[model samples]
Target: MLTKTEVVIGMTFLVLALLAISVLAVLASTCLVYPIAIDYFGIDQLTGLSRGELIKNYSVLMAYLTRPWVNDLVMPYFRASREGLIHFAEVRRLLLFSQLVAISCLAFTGFWLKRLQGLGQLHHLKRWLLNTCAILLAFCGLIACDFSRAFILFHRLFFQNNYWIFDPRFDPVILALPQGFFAWCAGLAVFYLLGQLILLYIFSIYKEGQAL
Candidate 1:
């Protein structure tokens, strides 16, 4: 049997892994949705850029966000103020942090799971999944209710400055990327997280029943 401390540590690792995976999912969805959102929302017309130009610039932005070595964001058609650039830099750091957390927690969770399996305690994972799912569902619901406020709150929580508030005159890229696009990204992330957790929950139940 596991001690209380061991069980708590295991659950903490599981929860962190789940949250990090969700963050990664949202970032991936953000990249994938850029082109679709641009076309669907008539961003080209709004920004006075051709479809190809918009895609090219947006691609550069996404590449900068994902690649650690790319230190500067150079969009051909868009210019960013110092504050906007700083905000993007901060976003890149946050993404890298989330990726690292996901990798480390997942690796640790693997060993923890192996230990649990040896002790016939793997079924305890189901409880962790259920509780995390409930919390994530509430978060998704809150975002769905008023995403604008949630978006601002998210920036405030993650960033120490107000650099995220971009001026359209300086950062035309914000015009291409609308709040609705982010809302879609959030929805996709929630979908991915919930589906993953529910599947794990079912598999855990199956494993428990099999041992009976």
Candidate 2:
């Protein structure tokens, strides 16, 4: 039978491995998306397309890109595709997939921690896990912000042809600002949750130690 400490450590390793695998999978999917997009949609389509058009194109690309067979080979190739070598869709897909994987990993980690708490063995691990989660969340938020800024800049510089149709000027002012603002809010929420978890862990440890 696995001791509590062993279980905790095993689960931690599992979660980390899954997270890493998911990140790699996402990156690979993204690489495939780019070339396929460039081929089907064309550079002009990518640069000059409206947001709606881009989304529609992306959906179509993802449909084909994420097939089981393709995904298997595409992932590592994406990692290999350095700066200018890869397609935009490849990068985009990777980012999208990575976020999804991260979210899933975090959720699973939380679920496991909850189980540990129920078993009365989570006190020591919870603090460290919550702090790690908070840091990861903050990093994710920063990445999201960077992507948003890059997307906007890419559109402004390259896709400025359809000025009237693709105008994001007003959208940025009203909606995009809030979107950026909420990312910070999300980071803070993660930080707060980490603090709460740490407190809970401390209380648990104290209570358990007292009972001994």
Candidate 3:
């Protein structure tokens, strides 16, 4: 049978895994972490502008993403995104920490499942993990349904100020970013997390079958 400590460690790791995946989803949507991030921040013939004008302005817009200091028009916009850039760096740190936690949890959980026998208690633990996944998926579903409201609410809960709210004239990059992409990323994160839970649950079942 698995001890209380073993079960706690496994459950704790699962929690961290969920958090890590969720963070990745946000980073991916921000296009800061994803390679395709630059693709998400461009405009073609923006309102009241011809194709040539859009292209001319887009050249500067692209600069805000890469080396903003070299461009004078978007220097202020680059400065404005500084706080958000710091937050993104912190997110990378969080992702690293969460990955470490997930690895530790997976190691302990795998050890208990493989090296040890008589883990009848793991059945209950599996059920508990399933319940936790259900709750997380439900929350993700809510966010998926009304992403704009949820996104705003999420920012309100996490961010202290309204710095995220950017004007198109100041930071066109933010305007270029679509809310739908964020919604899709959130859904993808939840699905990825659900897959992890399913894997754990299946492993428990497979182990049980082996015992029989």
Candidate 4:
């Protein structure tokens, strides 16, 4: 049997892993997520560029986003979003590192939990963890359903300044990015979290029945 300390540690790792998954999903769904945004919401349109120009501009823009400082790039779009892009690049870098740690925690804790508990009453713990995730994901779903308000709230949390607000007069790139794009990303995160919760619930029932 797993000790109480082991159960607590393993449960903590599992919850952190789930939360990291949710964070990574939404962040990885943005304009900077690469080929995912090659087309404007899956359409062939660039803000101020023609077909021949889009390929070049798109490649340069994506590359610039990866750099923390790209002052040499004389692009209007990049300059407009320069500060926000730099901040987002930093955010993405940090999230990637944290995700690695979260995965390692899940793997180590999960292996030990399985070895020590051997799928015995530990099924209850798993079910409880899943239930917790379900409740958390339910809140995410609510945010997705009312995303405009959520988006405003999210921006306020990250941005102390109004750099995120783009003007078409200066930043034509903003036209290509509709608010619906963000809502879609939020929806995906909610669905992924909810699906995991459901799968865990189903598996717990199956294992419990087998034990009986």
lDDT of 1 by residue, 1-212 (tens): 99999989987887788778987887767656777888889899899999889889977988888878888899899989999999999999988888898999999988987788778886778877878888888877888889999999998999999988888998888998888888887888778778878977887787778778
How well is each residue in 1-212 modelled by candidate 2, as lDDT tens digits? 33768666646643554454444454444444444444444533425545444445545444544444334222211121222223334534544565566666667766665665666664556555565667767766676668566445545664433331222332221221123333443444444444554565676676667646
Alpha-carbon lDDT, every model: 0.84, 0.48, 0.58, 0.61
Between candidates 3 and 4, the lDDT winner: 4
For residues 43-105, write the lDDT of model 4, one tens digit per residue.
246465454454455556544544445533445333455765555455445556666866887
Question: Model 2 scores what on Cα lDDT?
Answer: 0.48
Ranking by lDDT: 1, 4, 3, 2
For TM-score, candidate 1 versus 3, the one ahead is: 1
RMSD of 2: 12.6
Clashing pairs in 3: 1-118
| Lowest-sum lDDT 10-residue window in model 2 | 76-85
Q: Candidate 1 at residue 79, lDDT?
A: 89
- Give me the displacement of residue 88 in model 2, in angstroms: 8.0
In Å, residue 34's CA in model 2 sits off its true spot by 15
Off by over 4 Å in 1: 209-212
Cα error of candidate 4 at position 23, Å: 4.8
lDDT of 4: 0.61
Better of 1 and 4 by TM-score: 1
Best by TM-score: 1
TM, every model = 0.92, 0.34, 0.63, 0.65
Please write out the lDDT profile of model 3 over residues 10-114, one tens digit for every residue.
Answer: 667657755675555444454342234334434332234334544444455434433424423343223335655544344344455655665675666556555
